[model samples]
Target: MIRTLAFLVLLAGPAMAQDPAEAAQTAAARLDSAATMLAEARSGEARVDALTETVRAYEDGLSALRQGLRQAAIRQRQIELDFDARSGEVSRLLGVLSTLSAAPTPLLMLHPSGATGTARSGMILSDVTPALQAEAEELRARLEELALLQSLQENAAETLEEGLAGAQEARAALSEAIGERTDLPRRFVEDRVSMAALVASSDTLQGFASGLAMTVAADGEAPPPDASAFRGELPLPVDGTILRRYGETDAAGIERPGWVLATRPRALVTAPAAATIRYTGPLLDYGNVVIVEPAPDTLFVFAGLSETYGRAGEVVPQGAPLGLMGGETGEVQAILSESAEGVDAPRSETLYVEVREGQDTADPASWFSAEMRSTQ
Candidate 1:
């Protein structure tokens, strides 16, 4: 009876019998095996219900593991600081002994007599004749070292205390949070919980805010810049064949209005008319492109090129090579003109004149001079 009682006491444990992580892992594996016992059953109520509960339990266990891990880290840091404080004290005590021996000054020792004897008044002396002096020197050196060590210990103790307090505060907060989360739906478990999720939520909110800022907001239709003040008609930016006709059909076979296609294959693309470059870079879907401004309220687009020669607001002359044709997938797009207010109308680069329905996209066939179209 005594043996059984003792066995029960041992099993109950003063140490609380915490499972080694490995043992907990093994238990998890066992539960996983149980959960999969009837995975083949398509509509068994018992199997489906058991599997769902198992999944929820697994997720809960994962969240608990993460919390436990953070607590473990706090404990480890506390232990490390405690060990370092003890070791530092020991080192300082040892260093004090070394410092006292290095000097022969007797006045600094607590017992000057011991220090005096270690160093004889005689001009020449053997090492053993000055035992008192050595003792006093050793003691003083040890005390000095101890003093520094105490300073360090004092600072370290304060720092350690602060760290521990902060850690405890954080741990308490997490403990309260965990307790509160017990009522949280299973959706709160696993990757759905913790700092990473908070960070992700913050990032998502930031992006949403940015997108909201980008959305156009206004009271009415947009205003158009005055185009009638322009001095003369602008020349076409490129000298190339119209690989695809304007507004008739697109490369995707979709009928789009007010855009023209010209493919030079590998021909040089240049600025048309004397104009300031609006943008000298690739455009979405159009590949490498250049946008130039020849007059107030008018934009010239030269797209599908391998190179660009100017920057925004830099003046470009007509026939100046902006870049070589990119002509990727055998299609090149150029706009002789465009309006800042249009939905899809393009600025032209293929003709001197274009047909527009009071919009930027114009009929290239009407705008192209008969003489220019033959070669362009």
Candidate 2:
């Protein structure tokens, strides 16, 4: 999260120059910048870089759009409250106008009572009439301002809807670009026969992880990254709220010692650091899982992904596109089904992550950076 914030601060230079109300324009400008870079890029590597930047732009644009909408909603609510508070005053003024319109001259000059009423009428006109006119004008001005603000809010909302659609399209384009890149180094590719034998022999996830660790140990390749360096500084694969924390018990009487993040549909998943893809397949109860070996004797297991990208042996750099969360017809239903909320209730798609030391599960909250955990 710290790294991402730094990246945003560096990239949002031009966008920050504009007023908050011009969020849509700022977002459009960012997209234009990304598109220009993509057009100029020639090689596959360059295109990948361009596409990644383009995704960042889309992310920024989405953030800006959400902020604009929230502020607009607040303003709209304030306007409604103001209008409601003045309703009685407005009605009373209308009543006065109605009475004066019927017989203005006769009512002012000769009252039903007598000449004393004429003097009272003159005093009221001299002192109170001007104040009433001023108040009416002030109300009219506020109404005009409220109408303009509403129009702007509506326009911003329409733009936000259009921007959301464009963001989805951009994400698809990014995935395609990432899939085409094939220069990443491979650690080791396991033969299907051996992998199947291992899977069939293993009774549990711990057993499978142990088997895979032994296989990689035999290969004699150096460990990927230092595990302690990332003890409390690792970033999540995707932006989401941690729906289920480590050591939490579920309705089924099973305790899950990992995090289940609730992310928006089709959110991109990325690598936290350079690591070898240890295992990429389904395990018992867990959906599609991607085990990453960042260091010797340490493994990062990610579960609940809809699609697996890159080969099992590929070593991906930090922040490289790994895969995506389910859209509408994949792991979302499976995860939601396990919830006590029931199948018919609204539920978000989730990504489960577990960091393992050989076979034992580690507390992920302590592993993640303080900033990252706070946001979650």
Candidate 3:
């Protein structure tokens, strides 16, 4: 019995220090917060902003759920491996305990070495029984935890589905609100005919931008607020990874004076600082584009959006929604399965950012804060 228990203890290995339950609780809290935000978005006065926030909350919640599920899967696998390795030993230990329990008391008391041997055996059994009990309790706890983690993953599927739906709904509402919105202060009205002519005449983005800079407001609207103070302190317009730096050559051997960011499908793009919309429409080879001027002779150009928001010459506040990247959001099952298999959801859309000061194109990396870059 002593040998069997010792063997079992050796096979049990080290206890898992990290708690999956805590991770599950944290994920649950994030999901709850997302749900609350979704509810508020439905009735919020600033529907566009509220819905944008709601979509962000859902994205966060879904990310947390994926992480939590991954951790739980890892913990579950470890526990299962431990149990599989110790199964034979545990069964033998149980058999020995059962035999001892069923044996006659007189037979148990009797020993070849008489009372002294019996007393020693009793003392050893007393110690061994508690250790065995402790081992059993630990195994039971592990089994319980495994069941809980499994249940958590199972329930997470539904939660993930709900979160995906909520995010889609919010994004749709935000887009609709943007289309209907007309209250933004306009600095000037763009001349569509002149802009079209400029677009046709200009061969390079620089030429187009230079022509745009020369445009004057017929209504004499005040210039956009000075953004020089916020230089090197602005947040990124979108959450993404820097795919290519300014002037980086691509596979086609083409070098562009802009940063290309890899972002998830439908990721929100916002204004990095208070800026006037210089242009918002398709231009040249770039898809839908948004050009905003934050200060005199300074332009921030965002390209490759699936949709553009606001309008030309409108002053948008910092963090205002500018647009969304294109691509379909991943299905909940696909996301969960990928998470369980330790695969990260891919960033399927790209956004191009360019900072132009006067006629010179500056590196966007120098304009954004280090902390903001680090997160990307």
Candidate 4:
């Protein structure tokens, strides 16, 4: 904010612009307040919030300082903008202090809380310390190790007991790092962070490009589920034969509760249910797909498509000719988000059927009757 006016002064005439060293000194004072706020937090929530915001403030202040310094150097035709701490002023000019003014990139490095920030009760915020942070880093490293193990499944490995020992260690570290006193709640955090991290993994980056694709927007009152009047056994969105049954599978094989087709010709698909479209675009390799809210907590995803008929935050219904079914290469394969195994964070399409009353998952398969079977 201060930089705006200072730049204006520079435009007017020489000797008008504020000294860059003075600007840095002024910005540092504000950064000290942010740091103090972060350190003196009472609640874990306050601490985390303060810490996050402090990091941003430091970054923004640093950026403003660097810009000011660079401009001073340019105006004076000097190689470097030197600051004299003893004199408390800008003196010699040498070169840009780019590295000294660098700020760390903000990443969601901490585990996901799964608090949803919507839970009204039984929520525990994280109390982070240097020790806790080290543990968190260790746990994250172990998770990466676990992913590698999953990839190299067929090789000679330690016994299951050994694996359990490692897992327990990781769980303990994570719990301490996040201040999660309960196993169940901690597991939720672990799962969410792990999944998100997977989508962001370099080798797993394609997973984002694959699976049932959808873009999750900011929190809002999600539109009600659109009844999928067009849903049936017959596959139009996906064209192919049954390659794998829905059940347990061999090592490294994709085993989903829902059936998997061989492959289909990618084409324009439609919204299978009546509801607002959450996302309509190419996710991963699910090609282009559509995500619709069919009912409360029920998400219907149509993947391996060619084009989309709608966009994110739009309303659509079943049998709506979404778009052309065929894509650039014309290959189609859709996975139901009904099963967690089918969900790929970047491309994952697993459904979330919140336990409303007496049922869990609501058995989407049951929704498809014998007649529905005849169509796909």
Q: Which candidate leads in lDDT?
A: 3
Over the stretch 1-376, how does candidate 2's per-residue lDDT look in tens digits?
2122223322323223334435445545666776888999887667766676566566555554444434444555666787799889888986776676676686577756678877887787778778877877877776775665455444443444454566567767777776787776776756667677788888878888888844542342434555567767777777677777888876787778788788766666777767888887777678888888777778888888787666677777766666767865233223223221212212368888888886798887656752452111
Better of 1 and 3 by lDDT: 3
lDDT-sorted candidate list, best first: 3, 2, 1, 4
TM-score of each: 0.29, 0.71, 0.82, 0.29
Q: Rate the local accuracy (lDDT) of all candidates.
A: 0.37, 0.64, 0.74, 0.36
Model 4 residue 122 CA deviation in Å:
99
The number of clashing residue pairs in model 2 is: 0
lDDT of 2 at 307: 73
Is candidate 1 or 3 superior in TM-score? 3
Q: What is the model-wide C-alpha lDDT for candidate 1?
A: 0.37
- Candidate 3: tens digits of C-alpha lDDT, residues 217-292: 4543656667888888888898888889999999999899999999889888988888998888888999899999
Candidate 4 — which residues are off by over 4 angstroms?
A: 1-223, 226-242, 248-252, 262-268, 324-363, 370-376
Best by TM-score: 3
Question: RMSD, model 1, all Cα superposed?
Answer: 29.8
Position 247, candidate 1: lDDT: 56
Candidate 1 lDDT over residue span 1-376, tens digit each: 1122122212322111244233334435544553575355343333433343333233223222222332333333444455477676556655655665675765433354565654553323344336645655655554554344333223332322332343234323323332332121111112212323333343432232222212222222212223233233333444444545555665688664434545333333444455554454444455565654454545555555665554343443344445544432111111101111111222233321222322255454443332341111
Better of 1 and 2 by TM-score: 2
* Candidate 4 TM-score over all chains jointly: 0.29
